[model samples]
Target: MSSNAAKLIPVFAALALGTSAQTAVAADWYTGAEREIPRDDWIVAIDAAATVTSNSSAFGAVTATIAPVNTLLDSGPRVRLQGVAGTYTYPGTVTGQTVRGVQQEGSVLFGYEWIWQQAAVAGYVGFNVRNNELSILDPGNPVVGTGIGGKVAADIYLNPTPDQFYAVNASYSTQFNAYYVRARAGFAVFNGVFIGPEATLLGDDFFNSWRVGGHLTGFALGPMKFSVGAGYAYDRVRKGGYYTSIESRMAF
Candidate 1:
């Protein structure tokens, strides 16, 4: 081949390579992490807990919640069923069948969650079923009252290992507002169980209560997560009482 022809061929090949490189770079560009929103199709979480709380007045109730799926959200229209029933020995050693429960329906909440990429900070506007039910300890003669509740929280990265999540939340009901803050970190405690303790601050019309406790959760079952928690709620009026909760959750 002629020298001129050979030189022209090399130039065309270089141009083709440059064009291919540009296309590849554009296709491969990515932000690294994807913000995944929960699916809207469906969700249901059931929690069963017992609270032994009572003042000079009466005993507390067993707390249970059957929260049906609304839209996919930290915010959305929802119907939550709350029930609490239990017995306690009064100062007089009195005990019997004590039960009280309530149901609540609320409008959709706004600002489900806030995610910051620059600082790796995450925040969420949390909405729970308003406390439409308040029961006075009287299994023989239970009284129900309607109330409301609220919550908001944020979490920030503290450790470089990305294994710890520190979170804070505020929750209140018409009865009274409860404030809670906690620093949570998890390690392989046993059998890969992630356990973290959180301090709870509770305030209300009946009395003031506080608790410090945690939950043990792990992916033990196939394609499912199992969690159970226990805590001690110290009431100024009700004295000292114990609380326990168990939950089974599945995600698709």
Candidate 2:
């Protein structure tokens, strides 16, 4: 299993499950990208999900995040932090065997935003730490290890008309020997409601894969918004399968 994917499991799980928002302040539904903190606003969010792969592997995960709306040290950049935990189950890592394990992760990020009457744009960079348990099926498995990585992301939101919305979010991150890329876009059906397509490409020296999907986002209540989607996934090492996701976003 890719350790990096474990840290990101919450994102895909939410996309398929369609429950609870991820990220903190500047929430991005796909890949859990976060916008720059909105003016004078703080946000909190929790995300949970479960997934079963074509390999007969099942996974469950949860993530909690928090951020202050204010800039860092009264500067131009916004800061956010996150914590995550999850478990993985593989029915046949070896012949007639089942494997299960748990993982925990933390991340910190900084963002900058630029706004215009017609559009808003933001970018972020951050570091992450992850601890994972090697599969129980392995003898003398490395039970736990600390791994570190960094990510960069950019997002844009556009309002062509008072009631029209269009947006895109994209990011790339690298950890240890693995890297990840995600991009998603949406066009409003009305006011704050939108539907869009998304793509994810991830891999390392040992593994590589891709997922293509489409999602629907709906009207906001207070500061929260939601989305649901389905997709096909192909892994270089594990082959291919179908999957789905759901997500919500809120800022207060």
Candidate 3:
């Protein structure tokens, strides 16, 4: 790997170690608690987000996960069915022209989750199929074609206190050598509402990007949660731009 890529290893390692420590502490605390364990046999979660950047690029993504054995609130081995799709627009080879690309991925992963009163973590590994489409030839585009490959993913949620919350999500796919990681932390300002900072890093064989911003998260209405974020984004191709995103998640 290039020196630039090697520099990221430490960041990833620190995050992983922090997650493991938090999980261990939460588990130990729950083991001695008298509260009854919560249980739900099935869960379906959906998340969608859209981002527009100043670099004349707009992107959108949506994902759904179905856990048949246990819900996200509880711990157990589960069969996870996931689907992800993303679309984006970028500058084309010809000046003043634009190109669009779409990516779709499907995975059937075997996963195990551990839940505690204040924290939860889950890990998954599976086979995935990815498809990519480009409206026109754009050598600047990172994702090129379709392939079948292996994928690994992890999710972590932490609520160390009644008024604080943190979440982390990371995933990597062998297809096109793609990877994404995001982390956010918030403090409750009102009932069921949190406001905080967020960061993201994502890349592929030919593209890399990072974002730093703030978010309003955990806005709950009925069974759905909503979040909105705005930040400064920098990418190898686009240099720098501002971005805004809105996300929604539902579990039932």
Best by lDDT: 3
Ranking by lDDT: 3, 2, 1
lDDT of 2 by residue, 125-231 (tens): 88878777656555433344677878666655554543334555555556544465656666656644567787877655434678888767664444455566678
> What is the C-alpha lDDT profile of model 3 across 149-245, one tens digit per residue?
8999888876666567678988898988889999988777885567888899988886689999998876656445677899999987668998898
**TM-score (all chains, Cα) for each model:** 0.47, 0.62, 0.75
Off by over 4 Å in 3: 1-42, 91-99, 138-142
Clashing residue pairs in candidate 3, if any? none
- Per TM-score, the best of the predicted structures is 3
Show the lowest summed lDDT stretch of 10 residues, model 3.
16-25
Task: Point out the higher-scoring one by TM-score: 2 or 3.
Answer: 3
Tens-place lDDT per residue, model 1, 32-107, is 5544332323333333333333332222222111224342212333333334333323221135333333434332
Cα-based lDDT for every prediction:
0.37, 0.52, 0.66
After superposition, candidate 1 runs with Cα above 4 Å error: 1-108, 116-144, 147-162, 173-183, 190-192
